[model samples]
Target: MTYSASMAVQRLFPTDEGHDLLDLTREVVAKELRPKVDAAEAAAALGEEFPTDIFRILGRAGLLSLPHPEEFGGGGQPYEVYLQVVEEIASAWMSVAVGVSVHSLTAFPVTTFGSPAQREALLPGMLSGHQLGAYGLSEPLAGSDVAAMTTRATRDGAGDDGAGDDGATDDPAYRIRGRKAWISHAGHADYYTTFARTSDARGRGISCFIVPGDAPGLSFGAPEKKMGLHCDTVREVIYEDVPVDAARRIGDEGQGMPIALAALDAGRLGIAAAATGLAQSALDVAVAYAKEREQFGRAIASNQGLAFLIADLEAAVLGARAAYLFAARLKDAGRPYGKEAAVAKLLATDAAMRVTTDAIQVLGGAGYTQDFPVERYFREAKVTQIFEGTNQIQRLVISRHALG
Candidate 1:
């Protein structure tokens, strides 16, 4: 598992395609995202509407559609390339990174399993960034245990369930009733890739659906007040006897759980890349500060203690980059990448937490202030470990896969 320094550097530094993506992404961030980060944060803190308009701008830049088909107006980039783009964007602002990651996660099911009609109909707006999409698998009762979801979709063919005698009217052939909690883009997304119970079977009953945000009987609760990623809205989606036609169902019954898990496998890689980028940003800040600030009539960075610390952070960032790149390559090859993805997530997130903390230590009192980006980077790093399945769950996945 020895990593080549040249390859790692190449991946991080870039070539023509990479440079083009990075330049385009940085310009968008500089022109649009960076100036608005504070404004977006303040707005979210005050219970105001998030700037959904920014997503449309990003979509116009091709940032939102990197991994999708070119026929759908996506970038058609490989996972390795896509993750690198994610890292660079995240290094600038964690919330935008989260939005990009969530949208990418939402696109997974549709791209992988949606019917031709569904893909053709749904992806144009979504990939174009006109409509924001969210994944809705989590419930009040099910977070880690997706099988425990209680949202039910009882199939009623026209007359039996209660729609009407005339089945031709397009009433919800099935009524949806349940609440999904911790849904990213809960209130803002135009559509949600949701899951529900279609039967009494444990895992077999689960089914995925394309639930529109404006669907009848669908409403959002207040957004959750969280410590970080404030710009990204997370809340509960209540479906109270909502009508949905059979056509809206994502896949055949019992396919939802696997769809959710596979989407997670892809999403975790995005989180890992973002974590690596965040850590890299923190390290850059620490190193620049250490070199400029003088103590004892000498640059603090010249001191062995500070030098060693910065070096360690650099090493960790490189390692994290390598780990995610390996996982991304596996995914691009259409190979089994679950265990590798879990390892990448665990290592990259842990590295981000450690590196961001040390970055604060490097800056002394300055790092603790709102003026420094490291504090925000530190706060943002925490959720990377918690979401996309907790780091503890990642360990379990790695160990279970190893034993198997």
Candidate 2:
């Protein structure tokens, strides 16, 4: 009937700053997200609505850019700390947590692969918390295969014709014309971190660009009706001769594939953290219900059969958290975390699916009803396994690492 301010799960931070950051995150979650998530998600499911205000609230609080450089207006926290903050946010609102993750993903290429000049120019706005971003990687035809994207970026003559040897062009240098599918915050983002093919070469042909949201030929499709996470609006980003400056490109031409792949490794850990939070929320709700709901002559939780199920749910949530945290620590240490990121994503999302299902079972018929949030949690959990590289794709990634 009521959501707790905090769950029973214990957290340990590596520093006082980490502790303070989480405390700030919890304060924001309590004040900003918890009060509006239910009504917002319900309203968004019926029509086109996005919680731009909530993102603004997070942005103003410095929560949106926690994992980037401080000099660039980010919080400059380590990934481990950042992910825990995401988990805390997700415990109250999954959509916002996902938005945070997606926003972080959009800035990744610029932060990781951009030239010093690009970082100096772009990082200020991207990490300023006043702006939101969308990732333009997946297409309708190329969901998991980055190399299969057909979006093309042809060179414009503006740069070739006496544009100065310094690579400074007043006019656009490339025109991106293609559609990016399933882009979150499509119409609402301030910028899009886009990838498009620049040549005929299969994998090496792609290039990354930071496309302005209001580009002349850029447009969006109608929002897709979805089962859950309604406030995280998704639609097609149509780029029809969307002109981009030479400076907007994040990495060198023909280097988009490697950039995208590297970014995905970090993105997977974000989803894993969020899934764990969702599962933890479900478990908390189930536990509270089990302790109160009377059956026969006593509480349902008094029964060993049902009690064991709750125990298992706790374990699942813990394991999921641990998996993501391990991956986050690896990333923070500047170690190779791609395989571990895949493993964490695979384990945490699958755990989310199982734990949420069992939580509903723990509630019996009530969990299936809209009166409870478990049903919504169940719906949200299904997509985590599908996005950020599906579990099947994750297994393949793991297998490749194992074989090598």
Candidate 3:
């Protein structure tokens, strides 16, 4: 699991701190992540246990807050620099990379739209990495179409839900009741960044909140049985009359979709970077195996066909890395990058799938078995195509941008 990071990827940082940040990331990954990746993933596959300690390790290194404002416990790194760090983490251990991405995703609403007081109160804890966050958006009935979500957050006042007598003394709160499916860190998160409908108006009716994990009536379904990323947990987040303080709401009512979309645009880049890293890891394995494994009097890597396949896979990995970085750069510049983000997610994830599959092909029988990591890579690659808006949805986003 000695992963040589991409040397060909050209990174231009506006500050020397950016370079130092990446160096810190690599040192942490090599020291803390790579050594235990396989065993952790294997345990996770059977036990459904998430590596909370690893996330804390990342948080302690200031890895979790790289892109936010330093005033709010962030590292103040740009998206371009932050994403490269993510790519490096994913190259070593994808589950931790994904965990970091999802945690960052959950913090977006508070970072971007929360009140000054809310930011002062919440951002420090969330960005610290000691407290993980979960996003509650997609339900079983509503996946890609977030507007179709049925989760409702009702304003609980002195009259209703039994908050009595001293009306003037009580702070405002809302009772959220709903189920969120496919939520990462569902049971374990310290907070849930939830989107729930506050009115009957389709997409515009929704609102966002930071619901405390230990709140009364907050619960989670059992962890999902998944294909890969076992060290990351996915489960249904359930809220039954969960009372969240009004101060916890991130944005104004009816502004949830925009906040969600903004976070999603950045999140798409994260997935793209992570997927590219996975591809890089798979390609590395394929190359190392090809060099050592022999057939018919010499190394199988000597065969022109196998060598060509390896070369093509390397090219694809590099392309996937470039695609995500391009989108990350646009975001770093404060440019409109929704379309580019979609394009990166589509291309990079698809490339991961293809490259991992081809890696398996090159490894032949050994790749198909658990003895080599290629099979696990193949399993993991499939989900990247499905989540963060499927590749098909990415094409739709790209097409709309193209049309306009």
Candidate 4:
């Protein structure tokens, strides 16, 4: 009935620094995360904001900005390590898990393709916990099929006043007009890495922009009533003639798809790690319940049927962990991991769905109510399969890669 490192079960990836990140991450989860999970979940379900103190505490612990350089107020941890940290936190709370993934997504494109000036100007706030970010790529018309995005970014004449103090001005800055749907942290973020069509027609027409939250004509619609990860906000970001300078743009003019996809690739890996963690948590809850919940004058753990269910969950959780770790290793080594990312996301999320359902089975009627956390885990795990690209879309990505 106790959770130990041995019973908690994470296979160590073979990196010295990675091991350190995992150890520290487990400590952070046990101390900082587990204590606050019930309160956080309660607040989230009430549609209240995540505790700002939690974010600050994570920032102070160097959990928020891992995988970025120390100069920018980050932990300078590698992606492999950062993902492990994400998994640990996610095992405790899915909302915090999604928030960190969104943060990493918001910062990645800038660090990868921003002009040095742009990175120097804006990254400090992003890394310092002073600024939160949302990546706005999915529109009402475009989710997995991003080329269909109708959001337009017209090139205005020269001397455009699109630049802000963040070094995001363009000589021929674009005027963005679009609605990004299901944007995580939409109303709450200080900035959004949005994509819009800058040229004629579909395909290569899209371009990226880093729009500030206070930009004129920028606003968010009402939050979505979601099934899970309710701690993280999701809304539609509206851009009505929002000015965007070329300086705010990351990568080249026709490079939106690649940039978005690459960032999504990394984001998917984080999601997989997170989903695996959720599955693991569900397994833990089921195991604990089976050990203590007596039936027929004996603990349910002694029953053959319940014992086999626990065994199956163990295998599934381990498989999911291995899937995500393999993807993390590839990404850490700077390899092309598009297919691997999709696979990790798909398998891990599916495992979460299966394991959580079985967790409820273990608890019988008790799992069906708010009296136990397993039902909440069941609800929360549902969204991981839907967002970060649907499981169906992940399959498409994998199929396309295999064919190509």
* lDDT winner: 2
Candidate with top TM-score is 2
Give candidate 2 misplaced runs (Cα > 4 Å): 158-168
- Model 3 pairs in collision: none
lDDT of 2: 0.91
Give the RMSD in angstroms, all C-alphas superposed, for model 3. Answer: 3.3
Expressed as tens digits, the lDDT of each residue in 1-404 for candidate 3 is 34364434566777898888877888898889988988999999888778888988999999998998899899888888888889889888888898889989999888888777778888999988689998888999999988899999998874222122211225446889989999998898999999999998866899888888898998888999998999889999888999877677777778899999999999999999999988988898888888888898898999999999988888888788788888888887888899999989998999999999998998899999998888988888899998889898899999999998
Name the regions of candidate 4 deviating beyond 4 angstroms.
1-7, 11-20, 160-172
| TM-score for each model | 0.92, 0.97, 0.94, 0.93
Q: In terms of lDDT, which candidate is stronger, 1 or 3?
A: 3
In candidate 1, which residue pairs get closer than 3 Å at backbone N, Cα or C atoms, i.e. clash? none
**Cα deviation of 290 in candidate 2 (Å)?**
0.5
Residue 81: error of model 1 in Å?
1.3
Could you give me the TM-score of model 1 versus the true structure? 0.92
Error of 3 at 49 (Å): 1.3
